[model samples]
Each structure stands twice: as structure tokens, then as C-alpha cells.
Target: MGMKDKFQDQAGQRQQQANDKTGESREKAGQRSSQQRERSSQQRDRARQDIDDTRDEMEDRFNQDYDA
Candidate 1:
């Protein structure tokens, strides 16, 4: 092949490699975002549970004082 043809072939190969890498990176980023969202959901659930527990405890304390 001529020199120009070889250079063109190499450029095409490089472009394909770059496209493949970009696709893989996008998939990885999506996975990480999903994981982060799951973590945030778990944290929110825990906070809600804590709030409920505190409210119940306060109600119990008030009842005890009222009874006494």
C-alpha cells in the first residue's frame, strides 16, 4: 500500500478505539450514578426511621410523666 493509504488506515483504527473507549466510559459512569442513588435512598430511609423512633420515645416519656 502507499504511505498515504497506511496513514489513513491507522487513523481509522484510532478513531474506532476512541469510540469504543468512550462507550465503555459512559456505561461505567451510569453504573456509578445508580450506585450513588441507591446509597442516598438508604440514607434517607435510615433518617426517617430515626425520626420515628425519636417521636415514639418522646410520646412514651410524656405518658410516664402524666401518669405519675
Candidate 2:
């Protein structure tokens, strides 16, 4: 091939490689974000559950003391 053609081919290959790397990086970032969101949701749910349990325990103690 001519020099010009060879140069063009190399440039095209480099562009494709860059595009592929960009795509992979984006995919990994998306996955990490999704995982973080899921963990946050779980933590919130657990905190709510703990609050409910504590409230119930306090109510039970008050009721028993009043009865006695």
C-alpha cells in the first residue's frame, strides 16, 4: 500500500481502540454506581427496621410499668 493509505489505516485502528476503551470504562462506571445505589438502599431499610424495633420495645416497657 502507499504511504498515505498505510497512515490512514493506522489512524483508523487507533481510533477504534480508543473508542473501545471509552466504552469499557463507561460500562464499569455504570456498574459501580448501580452497586453503590443498591447498598445505600439496603442501609436505609436496615435503619428503618432498627428504629421500628426500638420503638416497639419502649412501648412494651411503658405498658408493663403502668400495669404494675
Candidate 3:
């Protein structure tokens, strides 16, 4: 092949390699973001449940005091 054709081929190959790396990085970033969201959701649910339980316990104590 001529020098121009060879140069063009090399440039194409480099572009393809760079594109592949970018795609992989994007996929990994998406996965990490998804996992973080799931973990935050779980923590929020647990906190809500804890607050509800505390409220119920306090109500029970107040009722007992009134009965006495």
C-alpha cells in the first residue's frame, strides 16, 4: 500500500481503540451509579422503619402512663 493509505489505516485503528475504551468506561460508570442509588434507597427505607418503630414505642408508653 502507499504511505497515505497506511497512515489512514493506522489512524482508523487508533480511533476504533479509543472508542472501545470510552464505551467500556461509560458502562462501568453506569453500573457504579446504579449500585450507589440502590444502596441509598435501602438506607432510606431502614431509617423510615426505625422512625416508625420509635413512634409506636413512645405511644405505648404514653398510654401506660395515662392508665396508671
Candidate 4:
């Protein structure tokens, strides 16, 4: 192959490598974002459950006091 053709081939290979890396990075970032969202959702659910449990316990105590 001529020198010009060889140079173009090498440039094309480098461009392809860069594109592959970019795609992999984007996939990894998406996975991390999804995991973070899931964790936040779980935390909110737990907080709501805790609040409901506390409210029920307090109501039970108040009823007992009134009964006695």
C-alpha cells in the first residue's frame, strides 16, 4: 500500500477504537445512574414505612391510656 493509504487506515482504526470506548463508558454510566435511582427509591420506601409504624404505635398507646 502507498504511504497515504497506510496513514488513512491507521487513522480509521484509531477512530473506531475511540468510538468503542465511548460506547462502553456510556453504558457504564447508565448502569450507575440506574443503581443510584434504585437506592434512593428504597430509602424513601423505608422512611415511609418507619413513619407509618411509629404512628400506629403511638395510636395504640393513646388508646390504652384512654381505656385505663
Top TM-score: which candidate number?
Answer: 1
lDDT of each: 1.00, 1.00, 1.00, 1.00
- For model 2, where is the 10-residue window of minimal lDDT? 59-68
What is the per-residue lDDT of model 3 for residues 1-68, given as tens digits with 9 covering 90 to 100? 99999999999999999999999999999999999999999999999999999999999999999999
For every model in order, what is the number of clashing pairs? 0, 0, 0, 0
> TM-score for model 2?
0.90
Mark the regions of model 3 whose C-alpha exceeds 4 Å error after superposition.
none
Residue 4 error for model 4, in Å? 1.7
For all predicted structures, in order, the TM-scores are 0.93, 0.90, 0.83, 0.89
In angstroms, the error of model 1 at 39 is 0.7
The root-mean-square deviation over C-alpha atoms between each candidate and the true structure, in angstroms, is 0.8, 1.0, 1.4, 1.0
Instruction: Give the CA lDDT, 0 to 100, for residue 43 in model 1.
Output: 100
lDDT of 2 by residue, 1-68 (tens): 99999999999999999999999999999999999999999999999999999999999999999999
Task: Give residue 9's lDDT in candidate 4 (0 to 100).
Answer: 100
Q: What order do candidates take by TM-score, descending?
A: 1, 2, 4, 3
Candidate 2: lDDT of 24? 100
Tens-place lDDT per residue, model 1, 1-68, is 99999999999999999999999999999999999999999999999999999999999999999999
Error of 4 at 51 (Å): 0.5
Write one digit per residue (lDDT tens) for candidate 4, span 12-63: 9999999999999999999999999999999999999999999999999999
